[model samples]
Target: MSEHDVEELKGVFDVLSSQIPALIRGIIASVFSEEAGREMGKAAGAFYKGLIEAGIPNDVAIRMTENYISVFTNLGEIMKKLSYKMEREGKIKKEAEEEKGEEEAGERAEEQ
Candidate 1:
């Protein structure tokens, strides 16, 4: 890779180092046990190996892998929050539909 590419990869690694720990903490809290944390680390390592084997420079691969973890972690938070919001909206809509149905049924009975 060119010098520019190396610098960009270093930047990515810096960003990852700053962000990934918090992301991992959040992920562990939400989905994985402490034991699973170790496995997750190993899996990330394997992914880095695959990237290197695919012709990515080792340093660049490692850096990008760290950034990838951070990106995924942020993505997970966004998705989780979105899902929660959707579920809440669905519940609200269901409740409104039920209320409307009850009102209509009462009106029909009264008319009859």
Candidate 2:
């Protein structure tokens, strides 16, 4: 390949490499948010139970339950986003592998 072609390929690779960190961060954030939400729900339930045993008002207990439900709902959304991101990443990796295989096949053919 010509020097110009090599430089162009390198530039493209550099751009892809730079974006990798951001992609990974988004995926991690999505997963962690979901996990944290689950933990929060458990803690909130325990708190509500304690409050009830301690003779807290019915209104206060209802409000606490609502808040916990809201947190779980938000967590469900985050998990959905994470699932989509992971699926997209899987497709990208599969395509890359296929392209690499084709390139290797071409090189072998040329050698023969």
Candidate 3:
């Protein structure tokens, strides 16, 4: 991908990062909210109906929808893992710098 593509991809991830918490909250609410689940079911049904009406074969439509959802959700999952890795690396780097600073202070005290 070109540099511009990389940046646009990063923007997608930045949006997901902010929405992750709300997504989690929705998941939790769905457990106790029958209306929410029913609404989502209706939405899915409409999507399939629309696809069939568009002349896509039944089997192909189902498979296409499944693939689309799988890949889209995996994109967010991939970003979550990447963000976790970057955060872990940042913590490790911070700790290493702190230790180095302490060692330098110790050496200076000893030299005096």
Number of the top-ranking candidate, with TM-score as the measure: 3
Give a tens-digit lDDT track for model 3, residues 61-81.
898777755564565566556
Question: Over all chains combined, what TM-score does candidate 1 have?
Answer: 0.52
RMSD of each: 19.9, 7.8, 9.5
- What is candidate 1's CA lDDT for residue 41? 83
Clashes of 2: 0
Taking all chains together, the TM-score of candidate 3 against the true structure is 0.57
| TM-scores of all candidate predictions against the true structure | 0.52, 0.48, 0.57
Query: What tens digits encode model 2's per-residue C-alpha lDDT throughout 12-85?
Result: 76566556545756755654576766876688788789879889897998797788677756766765666567
Runs of candidate 1 with Cα error greater than 4 angstroms are 1-30, 49-59
State the weakest 10-residue window (summed lDDT) of model 2. 13-22
lDDT of 2: 0.73
Task: Provide the overall lDDT of each model, using Cα atoms, as 2-decimal numbers.
Answer: 0.73, 0.73, 0.69
lDDT of 3 at 20: 63
lDDT of 2 at 96: 89
